[model samples]
Structure formats: structure tokens, C-alpha cells
Target: MASDTDIGSPERPTRPGRWRWLPGSRLGRLIIVLNLVGLTILISGALVLNELRRGLVNARIDSLTTQGELLATIIDQAATVGEPEPMMDGAYAAEILQLLSNPRSQRARLFDAEGRLIADSYWVSDRVEWRTLPPARTRGDGPGLDLNLSGGSEDDPDSADAAKAQAALRAEVNTALRGVHWAGLRVGVDGERVVSVSIPIQHVKAVLGVLTLEARDVDEIIAAERAALLPFILIAVAVSLMSSLLLNRLVAHPVRRLARAADRVRLARARAISVPDISRRDDELGDLSRSLEDMTHALSERIDAIERFAADVAHEIRNPLTSLRSAVETLGLVEEPAARDRLMAVLQNDVQRLDRLVTDISNASRLDAELSREAPTPVDLRRLISDVVSLYQATARLGEPAVTFTAPEGLETVMVSGQEGALGQVLRNLIDNARSFSAPDGVVRVALGRQKGQALIMVDDDGPGIPPENLENIFERFYTSRPKGTAFGGNSGLGLSIARQIILAHDGTVRAENRRRDTSTEGDAPEAAGDIAGARFTVILPEARR
Candidate 1:
């Protein structure tokens, strides 16, 4: 059962559970959504970065390999030359030394066929400095494949202090002569990353001479790439951050505003709700806000309607009370048999009026309760409608004219779950109202079937058609429109109203409209007898299992 306080509250307004509220509401949802989006972008970026690093490293290795091969080809071709060009200065000599001193060569030797040094790129002042170069770590691939450069070409530093770095370069290249791959040496003045390549000369598998030159430019290339990586990464990260911030503002901000507006509307106590009167702009958020504002206005109108009904109910009941009291006073003065009977009749009519008022009040009060009530067992709606119309047709025939049924095919097994009595009462009331407005010999048409997820039961009469104004008010309690000088158009005026109440209690709906009248029979149609002169009442009930 719902609470009394809850009854006054709109059931559709409040819902249970987490309630979609946030710290600043929409802003928080925006932050969370953007953060998740940004995080996904960052993760994807990191994967791309790692792959880029691997590609850069592989590219560097390929460059280094090509450089080594070029140096080796140069050494092979140069080794065929005789003694050093006689006018060679020290600078030219150092260049030549680098060409012959490459460590990847198996040996960098300068020897005559008699086996004496002509000019070993790895030999400086005819003394070997073991400490200048690390020992070769692996054996040559095999005999002829080996270049076998001379080993440890530098003298000890104590003996060659002024040319220590040059000597050190010579020694490193000689040690690498076991099998030179690639090499670097900062040989000139403080070892500034200057380097060389060397290959030994051999004829008929015998040592002949050595050829040497500066080695591939590994140090310079490594230095350049390392410096460029940081700036490139920095620019990429900056762009990503700026883009994310712009997206948060452009996309998330408007959505947050709409969410806040919706929340405030829900929290409001007044029946009239407005959301700052937003316009229907082209943007998506603007459209959403404008729609919310429109919905609020419409909702307020419905609330106003319910409130007016509450007032109308009170006003309507007051008239009958006043009349019933007057009739009671008049009955106390009965002086003859005829006067007494007339006065008694007036009192009875007033009692019936009170009953009608009370019934309307009770029906209105129970709308919510009945809306929530569990349905009764399923009853085939065709059978229910047929039974009601058949019984009421007899009543109609006794009045102004005959009642006729207009059931179509496919209405046989259509069903619904509701109180059978309540449903039957709705149909009988419609038929009774139809008869009241109908002139003698006028026609009453009844229909029953299924449509749009509900069973449809309709009653139409060719009677004094409904006025456009009273079409809405006909179902109001104590709302009668009996033409003067007529004893017909009967009842305490709650027939249609009670009928609507019963249909609605079954999770259904009922509505009335003035049917189009026949021009040929216009003069013959009854006048001012019902909510409408040419009225039609439609009752809809939910479909149930047959």
C-alpha cells in the first residue's frame, strides 16, 4: 500500500536507487567521462611510442651495418697501394691511419713481402700499448674470411704521453683486428669521438700491407638522434593535452548544464516548472534543454488540471447539500395527501443527489489505489461486452428506442483482467446515457473488440449531440444537462463519470466525443439530453489471456 503523503505526491516524479546525482552533478559526469576517454588515448599513445622507439633503434642498427660494409669495401680497394704518399702531412697521415686502423678487420698490418712494417695504421712509434685497447672477444669467422689486423699498436703512456689518444686509437683498432665489426675513437686532443677503419693486405694468403681510414660516423649519428627524440616527444604530448582540454569544454560543458537544469526542475515544489526558458537552438545540447523546458510547462498544466478537479469536486457537492436541506424543511409542512407525496419525492431525489456526490468523491479518491491494484482473473472482453449490452438493450428498449450491438469479427476471444462488475457497470452506464439523449426511435450502437493493446468497447447513439464545451465536463460529478420540462436524461448526473472511473480502475481509459450527426435526421435527433447531443462514449480496457 502507498502512504497517504505519497498519494499527494506524483508517482512518476520520484524514483529510487543511486539517483544519478554527482558532486556538481553534470560537471562530475563530464569529468569522469572525459578522464576515461583521455586515459584510453594515453594508453594507445604509449603503445605507439614504444613501437616508434623500437623502429628508431632498428633503423639505427641498419645504418650502422651499411656504414661498416662501405668502410670494408674502401679498405679492400685501398690496400693495393705502395708506400705512403711522400708529401703527406700529419693531418693526412692521421686520416690514412684511421683508414687502416678499423677494429672490425682481422689484422691491420703494413709489411713488405720480407715481413717488415711499411706503415701499420695500428703501429705508433714502433711500440705496442696493451692497455690502450681491450682484447678481442671472439675468434675470426675462419681463415680467409679473417682480416687479422695487428694488435696493441700504442706504446705505454709513460713513453708516448704527447700522443696518448692517438696511440690509444691505434691500439683499439689493432685489438679489434681479430674481426673488425665497427669502431669509434675520440683520438684528437681529449678523445673527441674521432674514429677510423682499417683492413690488412694479403696476397696468396700471406700478409702484404695494411690500409686504414676514419671509421663509420656512429658517435655523431647517435648524438643527433638522442637530442631530437626529446623535442619530438614533448611536442606530441603538448598537442594531445591541448586537444583533450578543448574537447572537455566543447562537448562536456553543455551536457553538464542540462543535467543541472533537470535536477533543479525535479527538486522544485511548485506546480509550474521552467528551465530558464531555453530556446530550440541547432546544437544538440540546446535542443535537449529546450525540450526539457517544454516538458516542464506541459507537466505544470496537468498538475493544474488535477488541482481544479479537487476544487470542482468540492463545489459540486455543496449544491446538493443545500437542496437536500430545503427539501427536508418543506416536507415538515405537508398539509394534504398530494402535497405530502410531492414533498417526499423531492426529499428522495435529494438523497439520490447526495449518493451521486459521495460516489464521485469515492471514485476520484480511489483512482490511484485502483491504478495500483492487482487485477482480477482474466475474463474474455467480447463476452463481457456482449453480456452488458444485451442486458442494457432491454432497458434501452423500455425507454426511448431500441439498443443495437455492432460487434465486428475477431472480438470473440479478446480478454482482460478486471472486476467483471466494474467493467459491466461501465458498459451499462454508457448505454443508459446513450438512451437518455436519444429521441424515441433513435438508434444506439454498441461495439466491442481489440485495438492497440487494449479491448475496445464503444457505445454511440443518435441523440441530442454533445455541446463542444460540455464534452469535457460530461464525466464530471453532478454534471447534468437535462432539457427543461423533461423527466428523461435521467440519474443523479454521475453515470458517465462513474463509468470512466471504473474503466480507469482496470488500468484502462475512457473518453467521450460528439458523433457526427446525420443531416437528414438532424431535426429528429433528441436535443440537450446528454453531455453531448450527438455524443459517443469509448471505453478501453487492457487485453487479457483468453
Candidate 2:
């Protein structure tokens, strides 16, 4: 139930709330998370920028290669004719520059046989420095273009030049140079790729002079690519940072807080999980935190109960030891032989009582220890109860009480998993103990049935009921209703304790409390008011391995 005060208004708190995040701890996580995110963003951006630059460089190389080949073919036609020299006058260089300045061609250059740059479209001057380029070769053609001598080949030129180093290319070109056709060649710049083509001057298919074509518009290609990469890398870094922080808030922080809370709980600094909710958003972490908090609280209560029980057990055993030792000493000091015999008999009984107490203590302590070693095997619980009730049938009939076993309709072969001997002993103890306390001609009923996944065995007795205060402790080791020397009815105080241990070993539980007459019996309200009711022992065991 929630109180009116617990219900809240729509308004939010004005000042800072008693912090949801851990003080002095969240700062470190924040610093680490942000630093890691920043590093990732920076590295990713650099890699993306590098890839964009590489792609742009590759595209520019292809464009430059094609433009250079076309420029070489145009230059070769103008220079190859000996009768009229357009290239020799050098005035047509401006017209060549204008042609090469087209935006589609991304590079431009003119080279002589000595690998000297004769002109450049971007330089804008005929007096531009003739830059030296790395040695290159021009392809050759057939020997049909010479007009000077009868048997002279057009390849035997008069000029002795460095371009003669291209002898391999010359042999290939000689096959095609006898007729007008294209001659492919390359001239290496410092680092850039330059495509160029050659044409023959001496004959329709013989090499005499070379003309090369190139481009000068490479800057636009590089600039356009850089423009997209710059913004793309910047935006990617921003998104990575935001996503990392969001993930920490939604996922990492809650898990870390739960682990820290568990550590504090192990040290007993906190009774339950006291960490605040880091995630206010309705999501999976919210449900996990709630579930964990509930489990921690329940576990803490169970542990506290076990500790208190241990203290009670220790206190209960001390009184029995002191009584046993005092009785032995008193018997030794007696004088008369007849009196001595009587005292010895009394001492022997006390000794047996102490022995029973110690045995019960040892057995109860090891209940869980034994169960953890192995799982119980399946056995017929119906036969076990019948055997136990039959064993106690003579004692039960001493007072002429009615001892009846009522199992559910298909229970003759009902099976559950457990230690057969221990389980049978528990049933026998429950039945025998109930019989001893019942009124003459009263009914002691034993019932077995399957409910859900558990085997429920119940024993009901007609007798003076247990007091409410002692009901919970009756199954504890060494606990008994009768004081020592009450001969009317007192036991070794072991029957119920042993029964509980056996049940627990099977991973089950046994509880004893007064049975309400209205619920358990026909036409009887006496037990309902706590006066003439009987005690009921209910045992719950796992049916699959029960």
C-alpha cells in the first residue's frame, strides 16, 4: 500500500537531487569513457581521410595517362614535316598551350629528345625552365619513310641524342612507322604519372620527330575529393563520441554500480542493494536493477536467519552438558549400595539423553553437507509410509487410537527421489511421535499426494495442540516439550529433529503447526480457535528428484 505522501506531483526538483550517480566515482569513469571515445574518433577520422586521398590519387593517374597520350599524337604531326617546321619556329607554342589548357585534361608538358621540358601549359611563359625528366622511350615503326637515299632506312637519323637510349622501343616502332599510325611512349616526372604519344617525321611509317600531348587541370580533381572527406571525417568523430557516452549511460554504468553494491553488501556495509538508479529511461537496465535489488534483500534476510539459528543451537546444548556432568558427580558420592544402584540408573538415563542431543546436533549440521554430494534416486513413497505406520501400529493401538493411512487414488506406486532409508525413518518418526501424544480412540491420519511439482506428505494427530510460541522451534535439535524427569511422556527429543534433517537432505522442507479444525476436519470448530486442535506436520519434496 502506498501513502498519499509517497505519491508525487508533476513538478521536478529544483536543486540537485541526492545524486543518482556515485559521488567521486563517476568522475573517473566519465574521464576514461570520454578519453577512449576521443581517441577512437581521431583514429577513425584519419583512416577515412587517408582512404579518400588514395582513391582521388588513383582516379587522377588514369585521367592523366589518357590526356598525355592524346597530346603526344598532336605534337608529333606538327614537328615531323621537314619542309615546314611549326615546332622549329616556337611561335605556335602559344596555340599549343591554348589547346592543352582544356579543363578535361589534368596535366600538360612538352619534352625534347634530351628529356628537357620545352614548354608547360601552366607555366605561361616560353622562357620557362626546361626541367630534366627521368629517361623514357618512344615506340618505333617500319623503314619505309626515308626520302634521302635508295637503300637507307628512315631509322638511321643524323642526330646523336640521349633519346637513342630507347633502342628497345625503336625496334617495336619500326614495324608500324612505315605507315601513318600512333606510337605509345612514357616520360617519367619526379613522382607524377604523365601519359604521352609519338608520331614519325621521316616517313609515313618511320620515326623522325615526336609530338606529345598532356593536361594541366589536376588541382580541381584533388580539391573536390578533399572537400567531401573533410566534413565526413569531422562528422564521424562527433557521432562516435555521442554514441559512446549514450551507451555508457544506458548500459555500462548500471552494471558497474550493481557490482560495487554487491561488494559493499559482501562486507556488510549495506543491508540491501542501496545504489540509485543511473538509468531513469524506461528500458532493460531499469528492470535489471530492480530485480537485483529485490534478490539482494531476500538473500540478506535468509543469511541473518541462519546466523541467529546457530546462536540458538549453541545456547540449547550448553544446559544439557552441565546437567549431565552434575548428575554423574552426584552418583559417585553416594554411600549405600541400594541407593547407589538407583542413582546409577538415573545417571544412565541422563547420559542417554545427552548422547541423543549430541547426535541430533551433528546430524542437523550435516543436512546440507550430505545433500550437496549427490542427488537422490526415485523410490515408492507410498510403500515407505505404509511400512512406517505398520511398524508403529502396535504402539499406536496401545491407547486404542485409530491410525489410518489415506493416500490419493493412484498413490500406491507414487514415486519421488530421495534417500529411501532416511525418508522412511522421517515418516516413521512423524507417525510414532503423533501417536504417542494422541487421545484414546483418536485418529492419527497420514496422507500423501502430488501437487504441482512437489510431493506433499501430511500427518495429522488428535491431541493436545502445541503452544503457538514453541510451534516454530519444535523441529530444532534437542528441543522438547517435556522437562527432564517427566516420566509420563518424554523422548530423546530426536524424532522431529531427525525428521527435519532427513527432509532437508532431500532438498525439501518440513513444518509443524496447529491444524485448524474447520479446514482439516468435518463439523469441528474447536481446533480453529486454537483450543482442541491437533498438530500437523507437512513435508514438501521435489517430485522430479523428490
Candidate 3:
């Protein structure tokens, strides 16, 4: 139930779960997933490119090993100088190296058994120097080693490893001198990678010279590999950007607008809720917009009903208040005892009327809340009508109207689903209304029957029939069509209206119509053929499921 403070007011406080931050928002989470997917795609592409690079370099190294073997065989026959030390014929080997080289791709070189350079395709030299003077360096007192100033400190691990690596020709020649072929990837001093292969020229265990093949364009190969990955990179970037834009336009912006609209509702600047244009879409956001609008509209209607009910309550209470005030004022002015007694009676009646009106108004106002709190259950119309009529019979006076109940023959039960307490009150109200209209010796009969899959309850009174025009008006609030000589303020005039409201809430119908006399003839209107005998009220309710 809404509190008095919240009723009919736009300033009612909202719950705390509405304000969420960016990462908690729907769009933020979507963007996070998109970015994660893009990162996965990028990492997967990099891994693929890395594997491709390794395969290409390994294949190149194998190719160089094969080529080096072929060149070593050729050099063994061509290199025939210095038999004791096994030197290479510089001119013949140089020609072979030049023929084997593929310009900037692979380099071919020949080294003597003594690990001296014999020929090089890059140098184009017929005969390379067998020995060269060492570079000038400062003497270190700690050891006999010389530190070349231009080559950096000899103690530096990077420099020392780089210097050892730069002697690729000597390392291959030394390995080949041991009569073993060497081929694999090696890092150059400049941090570039190369595929190197070295093989020795030998004739029956007599080593001649070493032939080495090195592919120095590994950087270009890596560059090509990266170039091949460009498409995947571009696609990942495009998808990320597209997803961001789509989320912002379709989700984030609309949600933000909804938040702003909710803020406006919180501020109570407007009675209606309005979201963004996204409500036009046929999606979840649109559903949310429609639901919010409907909720606000319902609240506004409830507030209006409350305001009207309050006004009606004030008006109803004022009439009796005005009477009570007038009676009290006149009681003091009246000097005669009989007139004073009349004034006192008037005051008492007004007070009682005020109390009755207040009680009925309270019940009518709380009807909605009370009905909502109570769950509906199957109510046997026969039993219910019997109980209400028995109560009225017990309370009936000697000269008052007598109440009786009748049910369909052989019909064991006619049940409808509703709050039994509320429906019982409905019965009491209808019976009381019927008794009030009936003559002193008249009968108020209640009947229960089933018709068209519905439970029907009819209350009949042997009294003057309702006016044709007031048949409908009789069910309206504050509408009373009492007979002459009846005590004023006897009825609060809300019983019928409250009854109708409760029946409607239970998905039932109630209406007032006059019963026709037995003299009515066929093919003639009831009023034209026979006079109206008495008033009859029929209540219809859906039969309860078995």
C-alpha cells in the first residue's frame, strides 16, 4: 500500500538501484567484450605471423645447407693449393663463390683449413688476406687482454657476445675444419637474424677449404610477414570502431536519455514520463519506455481518484457538520422544552449521521487496499446467500420485512471465486437495501442459480419498483432514491456503489431492473403489457474452476 505521503504526489522517493556507473551499464559491458574479442583476434594474427616467419626462416636454412653441401663438393675439386696445410685455389674458389651468390639474398665465402679468409663473393677478391694486424687498443693492467676503444669495453656481455657472433666466417670455418656440416639460424651483431650453413670440402678425410652460405635478408622476410597481416589488423580496427558506434547509438545514448527522463520524473517537474525517440523502436528499450509511461499514467490516475475522493469526503462530512452546528446554535435560542428536545434530537441525529457517513466512506476508500490484501477463493453462492439471509431473519422485527433464500433445484453448489468477506458484505448490502424498500409485511427473497457458465445471485423485494431512469443511477455514489416519510440520513448512499465496485473487482456484474407481473403477454413490452411489481437486482460472477 502507498503511504499517505506518496499518494497523489509526484515527489515520492524512488528506490536506490537505478543509478549505475559506466562499467556497470549495458553499453560499457558490450564495449568491453568487443575490445576483448578484438584483442584476441589481434593476438591470434600475431601468433600466426610468428609461426609463418619461423617456418620460412627454417626452410631457408635447410635450403642454404643443401646449397652449401653442393658448393663444398665443387670446391674440394677446384681448391688444390698448399697440399700440406690444405689451402684453397683463390681464383677457382672465387669464381665458384661468385657463381653461388644470389646478390643481396645469400652470400658465399671460402675459408682455408687454417681459418683464414680465402675468398668472398661480397669482396669480389681473387685472393683474400691470410692474416691481418689486430686493431690498436689500450692495455689493461688487470690482464694481458687489449680493450679496443672503438669496439666498446671487452667486459660488456653484449659487446663480447656480439664480437663473437660477428666472426661468422671463422666460426663456420672452425666447425667445418672438424669435418662437420653446420646449418641453422643465427643472430647477427646488429640484432638482425640470418640463416647460415657451413660445409667442409674433403677428399678421403683430407679437408680442403670451408664453403659457407648465409642468407642476410631475414629482416625483409619479417617485413613481408608483417605486411601479410595488415588485412587482419585493419579488419580488427574497423570492427572495434563499428561496434563502439553501434552500441553508443543503439544502446548507450537511448539508455542515457531514459536516465535523464527518470531524473526529470524524480524532480517532479512533469506529471508524465517521456523517454527518447528510441521508444519508436521495436525492441527491449521500446518496451521499457512503454512500461514506464504506462506506470506513470496509472499513478497519475490514482492520484486524481484520491483527490476526488478527498473532495467528496469533505462535502459529505460538511452537510452533517452544518446541520449539527445549526442545531447546537438553535438549541440555546429555543426557550420551550419541546422545541429544545427537538433540537437535541436533531443534533443527535446529525452526529449519528456524521459517524455513519464517515464509516461508510472509510470502508469504500479502503475497499481497494483490503481486496488487494486478501486472496480470492471459491465462494458457494448458495451457502453465502443462505448465511446472509439467516442473519437478516434473526434480526427482523415483528413488523419489519422478512428475508428468505432460494437455490436452484438439485443444484448442489454454485461457486464463484472472490474474497468471501467482501462478497458477503455485498450480499448484506443488497438484502438490506431490498428490506428498506419492502413493505412492513413484504418479503425479500434471495436466489442463487447458474446461467451461461456464471454464478448468478438475484435479490427481489415486494416493494415499489425502481424508477426507470434511476435504475442505473441507483448504483452511483451518494445516490439515494428513498420513499417518502423515511428518516433522513438513514442510508449513507454508498452501499450499492461499493457493492458494484467490489463485484467488478472480482470480474463480476451487478445491475438493477424491475420484475414483471405474471400478467405480461408475449410480443408486448413488459411495461405496456403489465405493471411493474417490484425491483430485482441480479449479480453475475464467473464460475470457479473445479
Q: Could you say which candidate leads in TM-score?
A: 3
- Residue 360 of model 1: what lDDT? 56
lDDT per residue (tens digit) for residues 21-131 in model 1: 422234444555565567568656764565445444455445444554554344334444444431112333334545544454222333233323345544543434354
Measured by lDDT, the strongest candidate is 3
Please identify which of the two predictions, 1 or 3, would achieve the higher lDDT against the true structure.
3
Q: For residues 1-546, write the lDDT of model 3, one tens digit per residue.
A: 222221233455633332233343455456756676777877687967675577778888888887778777777777666645565676787777776645467777677666656666656635332423345556762343223211222122235545555565456668888999888777654566768888888876877767777887878867776788778777877777667767767776677666666656766777767764766789998998888888888888888978887887788889999998898888889999999999888888888888889889989989999999998888887887777888888877899999888886898888888899999999989988998898899998998888889988899998888998999999888788888987778788899999999999999999999987778677987567677779999999999988
lDDT of each: 0.57, 0.59, 0.76
Q: Order of candidates by lDDT, top first?
A: 3, 2, 1
Candidate 3 has which clashing residue pairs, if any?
Answer: none
Candidate 2: minimum summed lDDT over ten consecutive residues — where? 147-156
- Residue 399 in candidate 2, Cα distance off native in Å: 12
TM-score of 1: 0.52
